[model samples]
Target: MNITLPGKAATLMASQRERAEKQRARLGVEARSWYRISNAASDDEAEVMIYDEVGGWFGCTADDMIAELRQITAPRMRVRINSPGGSVFEGIAIANALRAHPASVTVQVDAVAASIASVIAMAGDRIEMAPNSMLMIHDASGLCMGNAADMEEMAELLDLISDNIADAYAARAGGTREQWRERMRAETWYLPEDAVENGLADEAVQAPKAGNAPPAPEEDDEPDMARAWDLAAYGYQGPRRDEPKTEEQQPLTINIGAAVGEDFVEQLRALVRQEVKDRTVAPASDATPTGPVAETEPVEPAPEPAAVPEPEVPAAEPVDAWAADIAGLLTTPADDWAADLTHLIGPDTSSRAAAEA
Candidate 1:
């Protein structure tokens, strides 16, 4: 039977590397910390990280970072540091690995260590902070979210975090737990003297004065690129946006209102069609007539009353009647009569038989 041992080994190695990378991401954030490391030393007994400046993704030198760490063969680990802190959790992870080592660990700082760098400096058998340098410690922070229960749970998580950081400070520093809490609350910065007096730095070194002639530039000193993000708080809400969230891309209120109006109009039209269909589709139970059709002729039995009758009054005789009585003697009746003149005397009416010829 043939066994694919090499492939299996390769797969396992791949998985392990992937897990390491994932683990490294947990503490590296602007809202949190991202520690970069130059090298790590681990043997059967101990693990160590040597840091100059900061390490992790956003903080320090990355070239040969893994190789430098893996090269060490000491059973008891040593971490050499010179830094101004960049990422806190990355430093913590580095510290943790050393703690995990079976043998005691030692930290040797050539220069200054501040912020999280100070925290790392403390994770040692006897922290040997140079007198000319400093050690600074602050708070442990992370960003998270949830509902009621989730919020309480997150709160608990934060408490645990604060406890861990405080515990580290309390263990390594020459101060009470209350004093550590108060100092962190104030966001205090420490100088070399204060660091030493406070037990943050265990020793001192002499830094040379400036003004000596500088060395010539190296023939091969290409600038190293950086994996970078700005740090402002303990943690942030979510992943970093590559591009800014500009107003130009966001929908305006007017557009949102117009969309809602269009939806309402469509709904109204649909409702109208539905109602018309319902009206047209009458049920069999409603098909029967309610009554016979009513006659449309007007009712005329009560006719309007005749014009109001006037009160009785006598009529007066015409003035021409007397004249007609006198003219009757002189005139003979004619088949055709004309009133062209004053009759009884005028030739037009004077005895029409005489005038007729």
Candidate 2:
């Protein structure tokens, strides 16, 4: 299923995944949460102590237990458990392997059988609990991030998981699936007596050697009153954890440019038209007179239009000089009329006349 989570919710899911990975690592052999397999002195029964959480070791699994059983080939086997439960998947697998083994299996709860650990306890051919031990069962839980639809799907998935757990419990405990589900919902804690009374165990037994028992958590303080839905879902609530507060959503703001529309375009066109009209309008000083100017008492006469002068004709060149020059040219004739004309005209005409000559 696709899920679009907000940034904060995504970060929260990532942090939770990292924490689970770290826990899985810490529950390994290096952290001393191993399954110690040994044989009884007479070698009649194989003894296995599950001192750690389910699926706690990285290098070992249900296959390892089955492998151990294969090595012994004993007619009987003893499984001891003291765990707060870790991986439900691994626990269920181990339970099935034990139930299917050739040997008659005897399951002894040392300290606690909570979550999937309780489910594993039910695989015993004859279940026994220590006097001071406890057992708890509850619905399966998981982490998810998504929208409302995704959340609804997750809820349905959890219900399905819870049904599977109830089925496992009902197989050995002799109860209706619904009844077991109700007990799981309540996070029912069962003391050894309570477990026997509820048909969850066959009988009570003496506590194992002090050295073999599961150690109490260090704090040993009173339970915290805080609500722990996640841990409670898994049937393991030690000290309550405070729920982290979510950050508030800030208001979203955006700036968009002026909206475009036909009306806006019309308004823009009108504005451009107005600007063109303003520039095209003649100035008041150059405008034609529309009416007489307002006057009080004296009125100044309007100035006349400036007169345009007529073009002047050049006076006729003096007839006496022309006549004298003509008479001189006629009297000074040399070989031809062209020489007389050149002498009458001047040096420039004389040069042209000589070139022509």
Candidate 3:
């Protein structure tokens, strides 16, 4: 077990350090990787493991990783997390396994323990972060899918996960669930010293030859670990989406044609019979739908009056006294008709001659 860092070890270390330096340059940050403290069992009987890089957002993989952890039969266990954090559920699972261990468990962060990784780090009996090392605790982020029922189940699952986190974080750190929720919502990040102060971390480890300078706790983004699982598990295939769909886009509909069948005439007959039976069994109205006033035929309009014709006027008769005066002037009044006639004809002429002489 006391093999010096030689033989093939120097070559391996150089290659790993080369890769780490390249990755750090490519990522525009210092290269960080998980390192298990060799001979850590004798020193503290507690070994620590590193969770680094993007995988930290997902926590460490459990794909055969569980078996890897089981190989460690150390009296005490230490999980040294140097990560940006990873999957929430996986970290929780790892933490759960650690929590059940009979040995004292400690989480040592040499660099950054963030997001779900921070949650995982909390599983230790004592949470320790180097002064230069930082610890961040934030909410989980992931995609989801399924039918309405499936979605509902997922929602319930998220609620349960959050509840467990609340209880665990609160027990380890001194704060209310409400405060945790606020901080998680804000995507809060904390320095090693502040993490300890906030009850999330128990102690701050001294910075070795490495940078263990504690940072000011700040805020960060939540990872979408759940969503990643949902995506992979359900085989999501569709257009891209920024947020997960709440319910299935389409619902199942009944086949009316199948239910109706080909016996349309029989169906109609049955309906008619049912209607008749209903009418007979139910009360029938005796009165007409139209009221008596409305039913009476409208009285014939009164005939218009005929226009009347005006009366004709007759001419007036000649006066009798004016006729008799003319007769007396014409002849002797006692004379007969002939004398009257002569008087009427001659007397006027003789009076005219005597006047002329």
Name the top lDDT candidate. 2
Report the Cα lDDT for residue 132, model 2.
93
C-alpha lDDT values of all predictions: 0.53, 0.70, 0.59
Candidate 1 lDDT by residue in tens digits, 106-145: 6767566666677777777766655555565665554444
89-157, model 3: which lDDT tens digit per residue?
Answer: 456666776777677787788788777677777788888777788866555554444467755665666
Q: After superposition, how far is residue 1 of candidate 2 from its true place, in Å?
A: 23
What is the lDDT ranking, best to worst?
2, 3, 1
Cα lDDT tens digits for candidate 2, 1-357: 111233354575455446655765776545443477777634688888888767653435555566776676778888899978766666777888888888899999989988888988999999999889999998888666768887777778778778888988788778788999999998999999889998899998864575766666677565655645467666886644565444553455432113443333333333333344555688778667787978788869999989989899656334355445544544432446544433333322345435623
Q: Rank the candidates by TM-score, best first.
A: 2, 3, 1
- Best of the candidates, TM-score: 2
Model 1's alpha-carbon lDDT is 0.53
Error of 2 at 198 (Å): 0.6
Question: Could you tell which candidate, 2 or 3, scores higher by lDDT?
Answer: 2
